[model samples]
Target: MIREAIEAFASRSPSRFAILVFAAIIALFTILLSLPAASADGTATNFPDAFFTATSMVCVAGLTTVDMATHWSPLGNAFVFLATQIGALGVLTLASILGAIIAGRLGLRARLMAASDTNPLRLHAGPVAEGQAIRLGEIGGLLATVAISALVIEVGVAIAVLPSVLATGYGLAESLWYSIFYSAMAFTNTGVTPNVEGLTPFAHDYWFLLMLMFGVTLGSIGFPVLYALSRNFRRRAKWSLHVKLTIVAWSALWILGTIAFLLLEQSNGATFRNMNPGEQVFQSGFMSTMARSGGFALIPTSELDSASLFLTDMLMFIGGGSASTAGGIKVTTIAVLLLAAFAEARGRSSIEIFQRRIPGDVLRLAVSVLLWGAVTVALATIVLLTMTDAPFEFVLFDVISGFGTVGLSTGVTANLPDPGVYLMALVMFMGRVGTVTLAAALAVTQKGQLFTRPEERPIVG
Candidate 1:
């Protein structure tokens, strides 16, 4: 009976089904984390902390109320690792993958649902272009790419960082565990360090940080981009417009962020002031990369200048690519919006990028995502501000961090009251699943009108 009900729901709305699955997973992990075996001291954790940690893990948000390395038992760490891997697969994609595995093939409904994850326009009533992202017929291949690429990349990163872990004076077994944990966290963009010192030990280890940056970049680029690049690594001309735009926008943001950090934080003694020129550039690059959903922090976020914090907030809010493990409104949304603005400025009737025209629907969708994300962040920030006496900058930083699932906090998240904690968890969930998905889930149906209303223009801004 339960299976029947689930099938009914899945058929009705993939967005809601995905939300339900994520909520269920978070709940299960919360219960597991609350158990005595999940803690280091053999005592059951409190409800608030356990629930928040579980939500962070399942959302891949990485914000924690408790000390991650010292508070969790080996068993608890195992649970977290598993939860992050699941979270990285994404809710809808995971469901479709599981269904395909069980049935030995993806059904029509399953394919449609999974395709929606890649191209959200598929969720609404519309005719989505076959060349947009992943086609419905290619859903099986996309799922395979998602699973296989994640495994290969994580394993490769783990092997590359294993030597570094061993150099830290840990035994082979413990080193192996830490390497795998860090690899998983890096590739998933979860940023939850397995050690209490976090990235302190590896702050100067260029090789270790580079490997993590590589893993995080791959993870944040979105599975669709990976799938496309794998098939057309040498054939740039064959790349789809979506792939082109995502790559271009992502690279631009990374470069701009690096420059911004370099200029803004160079004089700040706590972060970049003491570093030599070369090291400063490298660390700035790392910080820029991490700001866009990588989440690992070498420097103290609380010590950053207000200007740098605000810049980091923007980077975190933009987050990573669409349909990626990373969060926020997505780079593509911003890219589309930017392209639309440029088109408007040029008095072009249509938005074009990479020599391909973008339909109005895509622009509308991008605007909707940006607005919804901004609203979500603003609302969360307001509620959090009211909940705590923390400074506005710190509150805003943590709120955007939660909303982006970027996990770089100004030490404010750990001190949030229970109400704020719950609110942040909800923000994380919304961020992970996406505002579009949530909106679609709430919507009853998309009504199609056969006739159009008379055109009217209101007063312009």
Candidate 2:
């Protein structure tokens, strides 16, 4: 009956179909997480807590309803591992496995139509010769690369950290399991770990934190950039146009983010009192980059000045890049928006970047996506602030973190009161599913005929 229902639903609108599949995955996760395998006493699990975990897992947002280490048994931890994998792969991508098979049997033309409908931009490019093949290869190759890269790093970390674990004189089994889970969480940016301290024991250490941060940076750079990098290095080819734009935008955002946070927080006694100038700079830059993607914290995030909070939020909103593990509006979207704003200021008709004019359709997409992101953030902030008595800055920080899929927090999420949880959950949902998908689902396509009308501008800015 469920299969019949799915088939029936898929026959209608595929976007809705995609949503339904995601819902099923959410249900699966909820059931697994809600299991009461932990033998700990004086603790009880509730629907809200489990449901919240399910949402966080499926979204890959890393916000938690329970202390993961204490609340979950080994089996429960294992479930979390699988949940992260599913969440990282994304329901849409996994759903495509089935969708593609069906579409293929339906014929290449039908498959192309389905693919084109799913991603509207592909259709606008004058129908490339091997569009479907390219899309399929890109999507599959990207996820496979992420999975493989994550495992490689995680295994390496496991081996390197094993000596430390062995020095503790514990059995190898416990150490091995903890190492595996910790590496997976860190690399995937899930932020949930078997360790109670959650990366604090290695806090001041250089290599340990660097490895986690590096994994996260790679994860957040988006699959498109990764694929481009791979092809460039492998084939000895020049970097593609997309790769250049992504690299430039990503570097600029982080450099500015690090500098902005350093200036904002250094003078503040709460954040920089104990650290020397060099340590302050290192901590600030590391914190800034990690906040954009990785959740690991070397210093206390709660004590940062208001300016630091605002800067972090801005970085989170811009996020990493599309098809990357990170969320937010993404680097390219913000880049396009920045150029658009510049063009408007210069009284230009179209936005241009890197001396190349952005096509009208691309500009429209950027504007549409950015509008939704702004509105969503505004709504989330308003709703979040109204319900909770927590400081507005803290809530805003977490909101951005949740939306960016960056797991770093200001310690505000642990005991979210009432509507705050719901608001953050919605923001995470938007971050995970993406504003583009939401916009496309609701966007109305208009038809232009032979009849035309003259336009007159009404007001000046």
Candidate 3:
């Protein structure tokens, strides 16, 4: 039956029929958690929390409706860990590539499967004559990016964080595990740290903070963007528009967001009240980056002043860049939206960038993505606030953070009612699966597919 479903999905379905595979991957972990031995405390669990974790995993959203590091058994935790790995790598269509490679089944279906992964918005080509090709090398490169990036950053974090964990007097192996767990915890932005009090214990520890900040920030910026940048650092002209836009917008936002945090929290401070200038800047800068869907924290969210928390919420809502590890609407999409607005302001008919015109279809899709993402985030935020005692702003912050897969919270995640966790898990699912794919699924099609409309005028200020 599963085989039949795969065949049907491969041949003809919603382009995002691929996402259903992600749903199953989410379900598998839930099943793992539901098993009698899944919980260390031997508590018989309902399927809801387990399902929530599954969605969280596949969506790459890290809200654990339950206490993850302690509540679940080792095996259960292992399943969650693997799910994070899959989600971090591409959750929807990428699995088919893995399944085929492992089974040695490179049939026509496999070829067609590979095609979907490499679509390019090549405006220079005028029209795409064919679907973009996907290569084994490219697929391997993606996996390698996720694996190597995760390892180097995670392992380095483990080593870097050792002094702090060791201060707890854990044995070598146990400290080793904590180090390893925190690495995964930070990078995956899963928020399920082995650290007893999460980042609370490491709040003022610089090296520990640095390790997590890097892990979460780098891991969220989808590897594709990084790969392009790493290879094209010397030639700005050769860089894809996507790469250029991502870096420009991300850098701008990070700088601006950092300042917002510092200004908002500087003097009213619980955490920052007595800190020197340099420490305050570092803390604000790091936390703002984490807010860009990284989810790491050098300071407790609870200690943040109300104004600072609002700034964090804005950062979380904006999230990270596209085709990158980060979530939210993506920096590139946001840039495109702003560029489109600018074009209109200047009385231009088409959105152009770096001297090249962005096709109307791409702009429309970008708008659609942001539009749907805004709606989803809004609805999710409302649901969370209704279900919990947390302040409206904090819940909105958590919702965006989770949806962006930025796992930072206002210290309220552990105390949420089951309904609250479930709402958050759903938001995370939408965020991670991505707004574009979700929008595509709902769209009315030409011959049942969406089509570009000719430019039209509407009144605007």
Candidate 4:
């Protein structure tokens, strides 16, 4: 009877099921974290702090009102690590994974639930095309890939960063644990540092920073792209348009952000002024990479110039790829909108990319995502501004960070009042689950119209 109820709920609304699952996880973690056993000083954490931390962890957003390295005890850290792993896998995907393990196979309903995480259209009441991110038949393989690839890459990263940690005068066991923690946080793009000093010690360690960057980039590029690349790495011509657009747009944004930071922050004494040209360039690259959902920082975000801060805001707002650990509207959405604009400029009616035509529905979805994301950030910013006396730039930056789940903050998040913290938590939740998924969850049902009204042309801009 219980199983039948769950099945009915999932069938009626997969998106709502996903949201409920995430909410339940956050609640569980909040309870665990609020316990005195989770704190370093053996005092119960206040409800607001505990709830916010749990939300950030479950959302894989690194924003925190507390010092992560010192505030959590070993058990609390364990809870955090587990939350990030579950969050990185996503609510529906993780549920499907457990369901598969329990049943030894996935049913059609299970596939539909998991597929909704990769492709939101699966939540709608219609047949989804095979050409979408991951087809129904391939969901099982995608799930395996999601689990296996995450483990392998994180292990590889830990191994790669171990030597650096050892060079810093740490014992073998401690070094190993720190390396593992860094690996998980970096690959998951949670951005929480294990060390209290954060990334300062490794600021000049190019190799270590580069390994973290590689992990962040891989994790940010969505699982579908990873699955596609794993199968078609040798045949570039066979790459799907989604994979191609993701790679092209992500790379382009990374380069642009790096150049922008280098030029804008080179003369700022607080960040890049003291560093030599080479050091400045390398640090700029690192900052640019981290701004895209990897939250590790060598310097405080408050030290950046206004222009650099604005640029970081843009990077955080656009964020990484869709259906990945990263947040924001997604790189693919921006890519689609750009393609549409180009088509319009060329006097073409249809959007085409990589010699493939994009459907009208995709463009519509992209527009919706963009608008929803902007509105979410705007509303959150307004609320936060009213709640605090912080500068507009800082408030907007933190709001976007929460919305993008990018985890970078200008010290605004740590000082927010309880009410503001709750609001930010809500933003992170919406940002992580995605605006489309939230919209689908709120919708009672999808209706179809049989009759069409006559279309009329309106005045243009």
TM-score of each: 0.98, 0.86, 0.86, 0.98
RMSD of each: 1.2, 3.7, 3.8, 1.3
lDDT tens digits, residues 1-461, model 1? 76566667787887888888889899999999999999999999999999999999989999999999999999999999999999999877977766555556678878877888888898885337658688887888898899899999999999999998888888999899999999999989999999877888788789999999999999998999999999999999988888888899999999999999999998898888888999989988999999999889998899999999999999999999887889888899999988888988999999887778889888898999999999999999998998888899999999999999998999889999999999999999999998988999999987878998999999987
Model 1 scores what on Cα lDDT? 0.90
CA lDDT, every model vs. true structure: 0.90, 0.68, 0.69, 0.89
lDDT (Cα, tens digit) per residue for candidate 2, span 1-461: 76555555455444445555666787787777666663133244576676677777777778876788788777677777887777765445545555656544443332333343224354334244332123543555554665676667678877766655545555799878876776666666676667777666665665655666676777677655666676666652455545666778988988888788778876788777777888777777787777775666766778777778788888877877665667777787788778878998899998766556766776777777678888887788778777768788887788788887777788777788755776677788778777766554444542347886898989967
Local lDDT at 308 for model 2: 80
- Which regions in candidate 3 have their CA more than 4 angstroms from the true location? 1-5, 98-140, 151-153, 411-416, 442-458
Residue 131 Cα positional deviation in candidate 2, in Å, after optimal superposition: 9.5
Judge candidate 2 at residue 190 and give its lDDT: 70
Error of 4 at 459 (Å): 2.3
Worst 10 residues of 1 by lDDT: 96-105
TM match of model 3 to true structure: 0.86
Candidate 4's C-alpha runs over 4 A off are 98-104
Query: Clashing pairs in model 1?
Result: none
For model 4, the local distance difference test gives 0.89
